[model samples]
Target chain A: AQTVTQSQPEMSVQEAETVTLSCTYDTSESNYYLFWYKQPPSRQMILVIRQEAYKQQNATENRFSVNFQKAAKSFSLKISDSQLGDTAMYFCALRTRRSGSARQLTFGSGTQLTVLP
Target chain B: SAVISQKPSRDICQRGTSLTIQCQVDSQVTMMFWYRQQPGQSLTLIATANQGSEATYESGFVIDKFPISRPNLTFSTLTVSNMSPEDSSIYLCSVALGGTSTDTQYFGPGTRLTVL
Candidate 1:
């Protein structure tokens, strides 16, 4: 079984500031993927960014980047120059391939991010 | 990326009734999934709907309680049977394009169900 953990229950950052949300997971599989999904008040779940365990190079998507530590089983999301729109519930998820098919994602509790202007 | 939409964005049903939520994808997808999100809680995958086969349910979930149907490559439905207050949660439908290990699952807007 794979379990994702988001230590922070809630986080806040001032506009134009930076904030990092921590995530850790336990997985025995060598080939897996990590992801961050954001859900706004509209109840829409949007993919934020993804990091492949085999890739040592961190994944960057504009202002959103992930610090993926495979050995440590830690994948964190960092938001730079945060804006008010960043306020949402962020969830960390893990996906591993098993029996020739990718399994469903196991998500953490989530961190509520509030960006203050 | 895939554009997925769920029908009956929201509905309030009686405890003994059942509600079937429809999911439609703009393009053909290899895999579809159903998830439940309780109030202020994380999303839990209810089952994996695969075309041409039966849906695979996760632990603590059964086919009778939450029956699923995958009629085609771009459509699926999830029914919450014998609804109760505990079943009052958001039901989300997601689709995976390419069906690869690295492919991301795109989510629909989600259907909010309130059972009384």
Candidate 2:
């Protein structure tokens, strides 16, 4: 079984500043995927960025980037030039590359992010 | 991405009653899943809704309490039987894009059930 953990329950950042939400997971499989999802007030789970374990490079989308340390079992999401709209509940999720029983991505408890403008 | 929709977006029910939440995907998906989100809690996988067969439930869950029916490829239903105050939560249905086997999954708006 895989377990994702988000240490920070809530975080605040000034507008246009950078904020990083930390996430860690416990998994035995080497071939897997990591994801950062943003859930705004509307409560829609929007995909922010994704990182493949095989690739050493981190994944980025617009201002959203991830510091993926596979060796440390850490995947943190960094939001640069943070805007008020960036405020939301951020969840870290994990999934195995193989299908069937391991297809699902176990999620973390989530961090409530508030971007102050 | 699949356009998934859950019927009865929000509903209020009395204790001991049951509510059936419906999940519909625009395109056929290889896998479908039902999840529950309690207040201030992370999402929990309720079961895997597989077409042409009975849904496979996870630990701490069973068919009698949360009966699932998947008659076709693009649709499924979850019934929360003998509802209680503790059963109130937001139920979501999710599916993968195409036959793509990634960790990424698209979710529906969700059904918010309030048990009184």
Candidate 3:
């Protein structure tokens, strides 16, 4: 069984500042995927970024990036020049592909991020 | 990304009642999943809805308690049978963004359930 963990329960960042949310997971499988999803006040789950385990390079979106260290089993999300809209609950997730598998996504407890102006 | 929609965005139900939430996707998707989000918590996969076949439930969940149906490629439903206070949570329907899999899971707006 794979377990994803988010250490920080709550985080705050000043407007235009940067903040990094930490995430770590335990999985025996080699080929898989990691992701960060954001849930805003609207309660809609939105995809922030995704990283393939096989890729050595990190994944970067417009305002979000991840520091993925597979050996350390760590995948962290970095928000650059944070905006008020970036205030949301961020969740780290793992996707596994088993033999004769129906790939499923598993999630970790979220970190509530508050962007203060 | 597929556009997924879930019906009965929210509802208050009696403890012994059953409520079925519907999910529809704008485009055909081979795989769909149902999840539960307890208040102030992370999401948990409830089951995998496979088109034209039975749904595969995860541990700690079952078909009798939360029956699911996937009649087609773009639609699925989850019914919370004999609801309890513990059943109160936001139910979400998700689908893979791609046909070949390994794509990010796209979520619906979510259906909030409250049992009295």
Candidate 1 Cα errors over 4 Å, as ranges: A99-102
Docking verdict class for candidate 2 = medium
lDDT by residue for model 2 over A1-117, one digit each (tens)?
899999999999999999999999999998999988888877777778889999998998999999999989999999999999999999999998887878887999999999997
Proportion of native contacts in model 3? 0.80
Candidate 2 vs candidate 3, lDDT winner:
3
- How displaced is residue B76 in candidate 2, in Å? 1.2
Clashes per candidate, residues 3 or more apart or on different chains: 0, 0, 0
lDDT, candidate 3, residue B63?
92
Q: Write the residue-wise lDDT of candidate 3 on B1-116 in tens digits.
A: 87788999999999999999999999988778899999998998899887988998889999999999898888898999999999999999998875364667899999999999
* The best candidate in terms of DockQ: 1
- lDDT of each residue in B1-116, candidate 2, tens digit only: 66888998999999999999999989887678999999888899999988887788999999999999888889999999999999989998888774456547888988889999
Whole-model lDDT, model 3: 0.91
lDDT of 1 by residue, A14-103 (tens): 999999999999988998888999999998999999888889999999999999998899999999999999999999999885533447
lDDT of each: 0.93, 0.90, 0.91
Name the candidate, 1 or 2, with the larger lDDT value: 1
Model 1 is docked with a DockQ of 0.75
